[model samples]
Target: MKTKITLLMFALLCVSTLANAQKKQKALSFISGKISIAKYHEREELNRMNKGELLDLYIERIEVIVNILPNIAFATNSNVTMSTLGIPDTKENRKALVENKEASDVYFENTIEFQKKILPYSDTSDLIAAILFYESTLKSLHTYNDFKSN
Candidate 1:
């Protein structure tokens, strides 16, 4: 009887751990999808967003780009920032919004304006991934005009 109970408990633990891992993986995938989608948002779609929403989308794009920078330390620091934005408050799943919108309004507006001046290019390009070429080729094409103009 004791052996059977122990086996059952162990099996249950394994199943629960697997479920948690799948949940985490799904969350990461969701984050990645958001980043990908933000990069390709059409001008009309972006224009539809209120200033706050647009700012939030712009910040999300910048944060992911920063995470993959050359410096290892930058990647680590950006991971923490990404987690803060992506992860829900520990208390409950219902209240998941991590951003303090009111507190960030001033910074968001200024940052968006500054970014536009610096980048000065539309991020909404129709050139998505090409199956025949390398991924970098697609990336190059996407930013080619911007680099040339600069």
Candidate 2:
């Protein structure tokens, strides 16, 4: 009887662990999809919005993604990337938040510098600003993974 109870508890633990892992995997894929959409807009050459309008739209889009990442519990060894996350880069995923697109690179350097300062504060705006400046956040995450492996 003791042996049977131990086996049953072990099996249940394994099942729950697998379920949690699956959820994290789904979140990772969703992050990849958002990154792809952001990249698509960044490449648009003909957007006609003025500067203020463009900045507001960029912030709105990035804030949503930043808010999502912290809720997820990723494994220490998990590798983040578009390919590894397996989220398809599709026009269907493109979300145009503004009439005119602005390049994040215009303030990318400044964004990084500001992020470092506000990181200790753990404010929402700081997190969003850090992620917004990445040329490709997914790619940068992958590069971090590579750095870790080395």
Candidate 3:
């Protein structure tokens, strides 16, 4: 009984640690509203949650991506901003975003880059992935390589 209890406690502690580690909230303020999103972890803990909890998180994520579909659809040109937020929130990220030091700036100044190679005439799904790439934990230059692999 003591062994079982000890194992359960250990598991709980591990989960709490992971949850704490995974917390990254990025908020965007616009005239319409404020969006403070706790982005999806790369490990995909949603699968462990109950159906309702899964749906809630999934829907919030999807809603953010969904709203931006029109923007993607109407894109008249190519752009790839390496920063998660178009503007950098910190001095370090600002350097990466501003000096145009990122790998993609070799392509354009206004656009955001994708970790995965997007085919020509990339459609709505591609656009969604690109935006979600910014709003993800993998905000580094190599964003969404996992998404592409999976």
TM-score of 1: 0.26
Candidate 1: C-alpha lDDT: 0.42
lDDT of 1 by residue, 5-93 (tens): 99999999999999987673222211211113224554566556565455455555544433232222212232333344565524343
List where candidate 1 sits over 4 angstroms from the true fold. 1-39, 71-150
Error of 3 at 112 (Å): 29
Better of 1 and 3 by lDDT: 1
Between prediction 1 and prediction 2, the one with superior lDDT is 2
TM-score of each: 0.26, 0.27, 0.26
- List lDDT for all candidates, in order: 0.42, 0.43, 0.42
lDDT tens per residue, model 3, 42-147: 4344334444443344445444443333233222112333232355555575454335323333432232233123323444344445444645722331332344
TM-score of structure candidate 3: 0.26
Query: What lDDT score is found at residue 70 in candidate 1?
Result: 22
Identify the candidate with maximal lDDT.
2
